[model samples]
Target: MLLEGKIVLVTGVLTPSSIAFTCARLAQEQGATVVLTSFGRALSVTQRAARRLPTPPEVLELDVTDPEHLAALPEHLAERYGRVDGVVHAVGFAPAVCLGQEDGLFAAEWADVATAIQVSAFSLPALAKALKPLMRPRSAIVGLDFDASVAWPAYDWMGVAKAALESAARYLARDLGASDIRVNLVAAGPLKTVAARSIPGFSQIQEVWAERAPLGWDVEDPEPAARAVVALLSDWFPATTGEIVHVDGGVHAIGAAIRPPAPEPEPEPEPA
Candidate 1:
């Protein structure tokens, strides 16, 4: 039980297939008491997923963009656990306009981009700050991430937001280090989560990963990524923080595996 007796908060679980849901389930199997967060219409979806876990988890309402929800998290956790040992910030969203096919980068208005950044990136520090009072030394905070170091066809502003998330994780590591709280990101490869389906041509990225990830990749299975999140949440990564661990089948390390077209058979040679 890597997470034995730990109290963990997981966000963004909309379905059993969600990475967060898998994390919650694995966390419980590892002896942690898991709590999930959802808001409005998606709350029911998360609730259904929670029931499917080996041990059903409690669900809390938390719209990360809502200041009130942010302010109330500490109190919410205080009532049940008193202190939080780990938190998985598995939340992210961007408006349609911010995605490339709908509007592309230039056509997306600042407001839409701002929404993406605030929810996906800014919320990392916001969640950390909100939960600080309830966090203990050695507590871990993990966030879900997509590789933002390079651009993809349709990721657009969401990619930008993820880049910001990468930076925020580093800053969080620096600031929260004194508190002995760890902050890190798990940059997972594309998977068939509800969120990924919303991105236009996401399959393109999936195809790229299949060719590039040296260990190969699975767009359907999120368990590998979930396992990474659980590891970061456990005591194993005590000395590791402000890091982005790519669970993308090693795709992040090398250039595309797509071979150049056989040089056109050297143009039949200059035999004349």
Candidate 2:
């Protein structure tokens, strides 16, 4: 029971296959009272996902891109849980044009790119501010991250957004330090989820990761990543902040370049 009696808020849970769903499920198992967030039609989707958790948690309204929803989060959490010990900002999105479609990165419209940044990067601060009133010293803010240090085939602007997110986490850790609230990220490898499946060539990255990740990667397994998130949310990371714990099977640390097989020998020519 790592999170015993703790209250956690988790966002971006749309289905049982979601990484956020796994985090929420594990949080409850560890004795945390977890609540989820969703918006519009997807609220129903998150509700359905909640039912699958060990203990069904309350679903809150939080469309990260919507200012109204962001502004309402504190009051909502106050009414429901009165305090929040940890928060998981698991939300991310980008328009199809901003991804690996025919329109390349340069061709992507500003509107689409902005939307990607707003949801994927800017929302971290927004969430922190909204939930600030409920948190005390040592409260943790963990964000979902994908290694954005280098560009990938189809990730495009979403990759750029993650880069911004990485920067934002550092800045947030600095600013929130006085309040003693820690901010960190869990950079997970690509996994098969409703979100990952949307990327056009995600499977190619998955294949490379599987081959390069020293511990071996699983595109279908999110439990490892989920556990990492839960650990960050717990008391174990008291002195750790502004750090990214890569749970990508060690792929992020390595070159991740798949080598080609050596050419076949020409012994037959010698015999001839």
Candidate 3:
């Protein structure tokens, strides 16, 4: 019950397996009342997923790219919950072609890449700004992230977007800290969620993580990441902000382990 009585807004839940869905479930289990957001056709999907949570929450319309929707969030959230305690930004998307290939950065249209940056990166601050009024002092803002320290094989524009997200969180922490608001990102290992499955060659990243992480990993289990998110949402992280907490089973901290060399060949009888 660490989050008892908190009101949190969770976005980007497309299905039951979604990381956002797991967070919503955990939040509710800890006594927090959760609200969800989705847009367009995905709204229905999110709505369905909401019912599967421990306590079903109201699903609100939120098209992050739409100015009108962003403007309406505060009032909408106000009507749903008197005030918001935390916000979980799980939204991200990128066109297929934007993922650079071995040849080079893909020839995908720049417009698509720009869209990815805006939604995945720039949207974090925008969300904080929009929800500033609703958030209480000490309110927490958490966003989903992927480690962007190096170029991902096929992550393409989305990689750029995540880097921006990391930077954006730092700036938000600086500006919002004075307001007693906290901003942070959880850099999770890849899960087979709808969003991740959309990325090409995502399995390659998964395989590498499995081999590299000492604790081992389950690409199908998003609960570990969800729990980390809930901890940040709770009062436990009151003093922590502008940080990226890696929940990737420590994969981000080390390089792949070298394979053991084949057993030395038996010495020749002549040598004996």
Candidate 4:
């Protein structure tokens, strides 16, 4: 009952296996009214997923990169819920070339890199700014994160985007604090979701989690992370903001147990 009587907006719910899906379910079970968001073609997928939730809340159209959509968010929420108490930002993406590229970070051009950062990192603040008016004092904003402290394998430019996300959260927390709003992120260990599976080198990253995460890690279950998100959305951590709660089974606290692979040797220049 942590989120009792709260109105929460959960974006980027694609399927039942997604962490956002679990967060929405837990919020509802705890007495909160949870609304979801998706955009374009994925809207249908999110709508389908909504049917499986306990209450099957309304799914709004939100393309985090769309300025018009961001502008309309407050009005939409005001029409339906009047006010919002919590926001769960689970949206993130990078073009195929932006991740697991053979050229690594060099493979993506500025256009693609900007796209990744805008959609994944900037969207947090954009969504927050959009919803600020509708959010009541003591309202909370929680974003999903990965441990960006290290260079993750195959993550490429997406890794850079996540680092930006962490920084943005801190600044958002600082400025929003005066309004009684708190911003935090939950960095979860890798999970087996469609998005995770699509990343070519991410499985390699997951392979190390079992040994690195002291308490152990599960690449299939998102409930632990989702539960932490619910806790943050509640008043449990009244003064906690601009912090990252690692739900990675303590992986973020430990040193790497496995060594990274050696780089391929450079080819010798042709005889001239």
- State each model's C-alpha RMSD to the native: 3.9, 2.6, 2.7, 8.6
lDDT of each: 0.92, 0.91, 0.89, 0.93
lDDT of 2: 0.91
lDDT of candidate 1 over 232-256, digit per residue (tens): 9999988999999999989899885
Residue pairs that clash (backbone atoms under 3 angstroms), model 2: none
lDDT accuracy of residue 8 in candidate 3: 94
Pick out the ten consecutive residues of candidate 3 with the lowest summed lDDT.
99-108
Lowest-scoring 10 consecutive residues by lDDT in candidate 1?
A: 258-267
Q: Report the number of clashing residue pairs per model.
A: 0, 0, 0, 0
The TM-score that candidate 3 achieves is 0.94
Which lDDT value does model 3 have at 88? 97
**lDDT: which candidate is best?**
4
Q: Rank the candidates by lDDT, best first.
A: 4, 1, 2, 3
Looking at candidate 1, what is the lDDT of residue 133?
91
Q: 94, model 1: CA deviation in Å?
A: 0.4
* Superposed model 3: Cα runs more than 4 Å off: 100-103, 258-272
lDDT of 4 by residue, 1-272 (tens): 99999999999899999999999999999999999999999999999999999999999999999899999888989998899999999999999999998889889999999999999999999999999999889999999999899998999888899999999999999999999999999999999988898899877998789667777888989999999999999998999999999998887777767445689999999999
Q: Which stretches of candidate 2 lie over 4 Å from their true place?
A: 256-272
RMSD of 3: 2.7
- Total clashes for model 2: 0
